[model samples]
Target: MQNPATTAFVSDFAELPATASHGPLRIEYRWVNEAAGNAPIAVFLHEGLGSVAMWRDWPQALCERLGMRGLVYSRPGYGLSTPREHAVKWPVDFMTAQARDILPALFGVLDIDMQARKRMWVIGHSDGGSIALLYAALHPDALAGAVVIAPHIFVEDLSVESIAQTKALYETTDLRSKLSRYHSDVDSAFYGWNDIWLNAAFREWRIVDELAAIKQALLAVQGHDDNYGTMAQIDTIGERVPHAQLVKLDACGHSPHRDAPDALNEAIAAFISRQRR
Candidate 1:
């Protein structure tokens, strides 16, 4: 699949912008649509191995469609964000790091106190989807809603297998070279993510149980023919979370947004519009 163009979405010249205090490193981000005049702000979290640049223009399209502001950036070790220790792998509580530390830091830098400011929407894909759920669980009162695409609630054999294949490609093919354009510390970002998921400890990891704490309206989407995760991930979200909905697209893969943007965006826009009411 072709990576999207998101460098254009970043604020060309900004200072001390958003900061995610994940470990010793702080993430830098570009907050979009700050002047949209009360529109919803969508915080976009990228997939594993995905940086802001890799997400391309999807945030732009979603923000435009939802009449919302947007925030997009690389995590620590991704894109222009600061890199972290090579030996210090993402802890078992990596998602927790994102939910408790990173999300709040981003909001702080953007001067958005979710308690006082307009509640925002979250659009997350793959690993981002899991992070979105964690954010919702952490800040149920602050979210307007969430759209999680191809999320993993629990680890799966296929998920690991797919990551292995991707690792092979990254080593043998031009995958790393391609990802390099998107991430300033591409190796750190890639190995940090890859090693964690492939770790034996991560196989039993599951967030579906913890996500029941979330009160925000939820929309979980997955492709039936997904190469990584199955539609059961979305089903798990719907079963465990209150006011949750699911959409299983046929002939779709792990990346429904890239594989079926029109259908994906249409479903997302509709879902977001309904949540506002």
Candidate 2:
């Protein structure tokens, strides 16, 4: 991992106009290889309950390896970004809202021109992976390709069971304390994801139709031992997208970027290089 002291990334904050009754939100973002002039840019989207800080040095490491610029940011309810108001329940289409609304707003604020950029990529993990898929679908011509790690195409029974266990651990264990280290408002991040998943209506959440609309190059990766999802997630993506590639890692779990960083980085770097060529 690159040391923070010598890393070339700059962390900053942007104020984005609120889409609803909440006031303007502050989004925490980091720019990697900002001086790499006109090179392809890869945007890293974190998992549910993830923040810019939670991604640690992975984005920088991957960008450095690929010789590309990177943009990493915390969603509204994560990291130092704006926290959701108290008692606000995320809607069933929360991921859609993010892909269709918040992300475009952020890209505009950051001055990233999707139309002009020839090699723009979206690298997303878990919930972020789902969001990336949604984004690519919504704006098919805007992306060169996408890398989705441990993404969910549909809600699964195992997902609900594991999420339930997580809720138990959050209440009865030190999980909340540990999570507090990564998020400024832990509850805002946690319940925003957790409640939505466990909600009765969320059981019907699925993105298969959205996946069909994505025409860009796609690489879908998941761990063989993932507790949050199964190979079926990526398999279904391939089934729907037709050209999507699937990678399943052994001895890995939901968080492949953490559990298998070297392998994941190599796979993604190679995939991006090929797509660019």
Which candidate number maximizes lDDT? 2
Reference-based TM-score of each model? 0.90, 0.93
Q: Report lDDT per candidate.
A: 0.79, 0.87
Ten consecutive residues with minimal summed lDDT in candidate 2? 1-10
* Model 2 regions lying over 4 Å from their true place: 1-10, 20-23, 115-118
lDDT of 1 by residue, 134-210 (tens): 98888778888888999888998999999999999999999988788787667888899999999999987898778
Q: Which stretches of candidate 1 lie over 4 Å from their true place?
A: 1-24, 33-35, 115-118
lDDT by residue (tens digit), candidate 2, 1-277: 2224322344588878866734687888888876676778899999998888788888888888988888999898987788887599999989998888888888888888856444689999999999999999998888888999999889999999999999999999999988886777788889888999999999999998888899999999999999999899999998998998888899999999999998898899888778766
In angstroms, give how far residue 32 of model 2 lies from its true place. 1.7
- How far off is residue 78 in model 2, in Å? 0.6
